[model samples]
Target: MPESATAAPPLQVSSETAPLRQVVVHTPGEEMALVAPGNKDELLFDDLLFVEEAREEHATLVRLFEAAIGDAGAEGGAVLQLSDLLREAFDGADARESFVEALVELLPERNFEAYEAELKALGPDALHRFALTGQAPFAVSATPLPNLLFTRDLSAVVGDHPILSLAATAARRPESAIIRTIYHHHPRFAAARERLIELPEDVTFEGGDLLVVNERVVMIGQSERTSLGGVLAVARALLDRTSVEHVLMVNLPKERYCMHLDTVFTFADDDTCVVFPPIIEEPRDHVLHIEAGAERGGDGPREFRMRPLPSVREALEEVTGRSYTFIPCGGADPIRQRREQWTDGANLFAVRPGLVVGYARNRATYEALARAGFHVVSADDFLGFYGDAAAASQDRIAVRLSGNELSRGRGGPRCMTMPLVRMRNSES
Candidate 1:
C-alpha cells in the first residue's frame, strides 16, 4: 500500500515586490457583536456599532485583495480566510478532538467538556459567535472577540518563519489559539515546518509591536502589550534559527494610543518609514537592546547591549542598508501628530516598495507623502488601475481609502492586511 499524502507548505515571503500580494483576512461575523458599547475599551475598541456594515466594508477589502492578486485560487495570489482556515483545521474528528483538548488545557479553569460541546454544536456562522463572545451553550459569560478586525496584531511572519503570537490581554487569547491551529494543521501552511516561539505563559507579545525589519534584524516595542520577556523569546527564537545580529528593543509609552509599534510607526517603503517623533525619537529613557547568537556569545544567546531611544530612521538604515526619510504620522505639527496617531495615522501598509495603503482621513499625512514624492491615489483609483493594465504599470503611489469607520476600530490599512506572500525580486 502507498503512504498517505501530506499537505503542501506555506509559501515563504521574503521581499515586497508588487504593492500588495497574498493577504490573510477575516470577514466580520457573529463574534463582532461582542463589542458592546460598555466594554469596548476593555477590548481596545474606540466605538461599537454596525457589525453588519463593517462586514460589508470588509467584503470590499476582500474583493480588492482578490482583484489585486489576480487569481484567487493560486498559491501566490490567494486571500486566506481565518474562518476557512479554522474549518480546515477542525475537519477531521480526531484533529477537532485534539484541538479542543489543547484549548481546554490552556484554559484549565474553564469547563472544558462544556466549552468543547458548545463549540461543536455551533454551525459555521454560530461558531464565530461562540468563539468571539465566549458565550457557550451553558451559563458561561460572553467573551466575544471585538478586536479580530485588527488581525495584524494577532501574529506575524519574521524572515521565512512565522511566530504564533501570545497577546498581552487574556481577552485575545482565543485568537492566538485560532491562529496556532491554522498554521499548525492547515494543509497549505502545515508544510512550512514553522515553529512557534513559546513565551512564558504570563509574558505577552502582540504582533502590532513586532516588526520584521529584515531576515536578520527585528524591531520590537516594549510597550503595554509586549513585555521584555516576550521580546527576549522572539530574539532567542530568531537567533536559534539564524544569526540575528541585533534585536532593537524600543520602549514605547504605555498609553492607549501608543499601544503597539505599528500604531506609532510603520514602513512606508523599503527605504522610508512613517513615525510619531515624540514616541520613536524622544521615547522615555527606559530602552535597551540585546545581542543574540554566535557573534554576541560563545555559541549561546547574550544580552549586554543597551541604548537610548534608537532613531527609527537610523535603525531602518542599518537594517535595510539604505537611508530612510521619516514622514510624520500627522505631518510636522505636534497637535496633528497626536490627533492622527490616536486614529492609526502612521499604520500604513505597503503594497509594493514605494506604494502603500492608508486612511484618507489623515490628510496631513498624505500631504507629507506627496511632499516626499509619493503619487497619492485613492483605494478606488488603485483598484481601477489594477483593472486596467495600462494604468497598473505606474509607480510610486500611495492608495488612500475611506477608513473613518474602519479606523474607529483602532487600526488602519496595515492592521487590516496580513501579507501572506510578497513577490520576489525576480518575479517583480
Candidate 2:
C-alpha cells in the first residue's frame, strides 16, 4: 500500500480545554484477553475487564469525539485509532525494520532478535496484530500489551511539538516504542518530524503526567510514573523550542491512586478545573516553577531558573495571569471524594471550553458539575442531540459515559483519548 498523497493533519495542542480537532484512541481487542487475575497486578490493572463490553464503551467515546468535532475528515480532524496508524506506518520497509529492532531491544528476555528477520518480513497487518497481541507464526509468545487502552499515557502533543514518552515500567515500554516508531515513519506525522522531542532512555516520562495549561504554560507532575529528571528534560525542550514561558513542576504523592497528574487534576474550562481535593487543593503537594534564563549571545548552553510555589492553583494563577476555580471530584463529602477519586472522577476530557466527558459511575462528581452550572447529560442523550448545533453550543456541559468494564483498568475518558490538535485559546 502507498502513503496518502494529501497533506498531514495539523499537530498543535496548546491547551487542554480548547476545541478538540484531531485525537488518537485505542479500543480494546484480543490483547485485553491476556489480562487475568494471575497477571492483573503486573499489568497495572486493578481488576478484570470484559473485553467486548470495554470495546463497545470505547467505541461510544470515539463517536462522541467525532460528533463533538463535527466533520473529522475535513482538515484532518478525525478520531484516529492507534492500531490503524501502526498498520499504516508499517507500509514502509524501513518502518518495519525499525519496529522489529526496537521490539527486540524492548523484550530482551524473549530473544526476539533471533526471529528479527521473520518479524520484519511479516505483512503489515500481521505485524500490527503481533505487536499488540504478541501472537505470531513463530512458537515464542510475548505478553500482550493490555495497558495500550490508556492512549493518554503513550505520548503527548505539546504546542506544535510532539514530546515522546520513555515509559517508566517494562510493561509499558512497547507502547512508547510503537508510538515513537509511528511518529518516525508515518507519513501523517512527516511535517512535524523535526520538531519531535526525544528524551534520554535513563529518564522516565509519560503523557498522563504532562498537561499544556495554555499557550504559554505547561505543567509536568513528578510522580511515580514521571521522574524529576524527565520533568526537567521536557521543560528545557519546551522552553527552548516553543513560545511557552513557564513549566510548572507539580510534585504528587507516589501512590497508585495518584499515579499521574491527570488522575488528580484536569482542565474543565479556560479558568476551571476538576480536582481531587487531597492532592490538588491541599498543600500536601508542592509546585515548582521552571523558566529559561537570559540568553548568552553565542552558541553557549542554555540555563534555567527555578522557584517554589505554595500550590498548583497558585502556580497556575501566577504564570497564566488568571484566577482559577476548582470543582471537587466528589462534591462535598470526604468519603465520596475518596471513593469517586479512585474511579477516576477528576479524569475528565474536555472537548471544548466547559464541555467535558467522564465516567457516569461517578455520580457525586457529575452532581458537583451540575451545581457548578454545567448542563449534565448522559452520553446517549448527548449523542441523540448530536445533529443539533445549538445543543453543543451551550456554555457548559458534562457528558457522562457508561464505564462499568472500562473503569476496571483504572482510567477514564481523559486517559483513553490523546488530542493531536486543538484551536487556540482565544478562538476557542
lDDT of each: 0.69, 0.87
Error of 2 at 86 (Å): 0.3
For every model shown, what is its TM-score relative to the native structure? 0.87, 0.95
Question: Listing every candidate in turn, what is its Cα RMSD in Å to the true structure after a full C-alpha superposition?
Answer: 3.8, 1.9
Q: Lowest lDDT 10-mer window, candidate 2?
A: 1-10
lDDT of model number 1 = 0.69
Q: Show where candidate 1 strays beyond 4 Å.
A: 1-9, 15-19, 71-77, 108-129, 284-287, 293-310, 388-394
The number of clashing residue pairs in each candidate reads 7, 0
Model 1 TM-score is 0.87
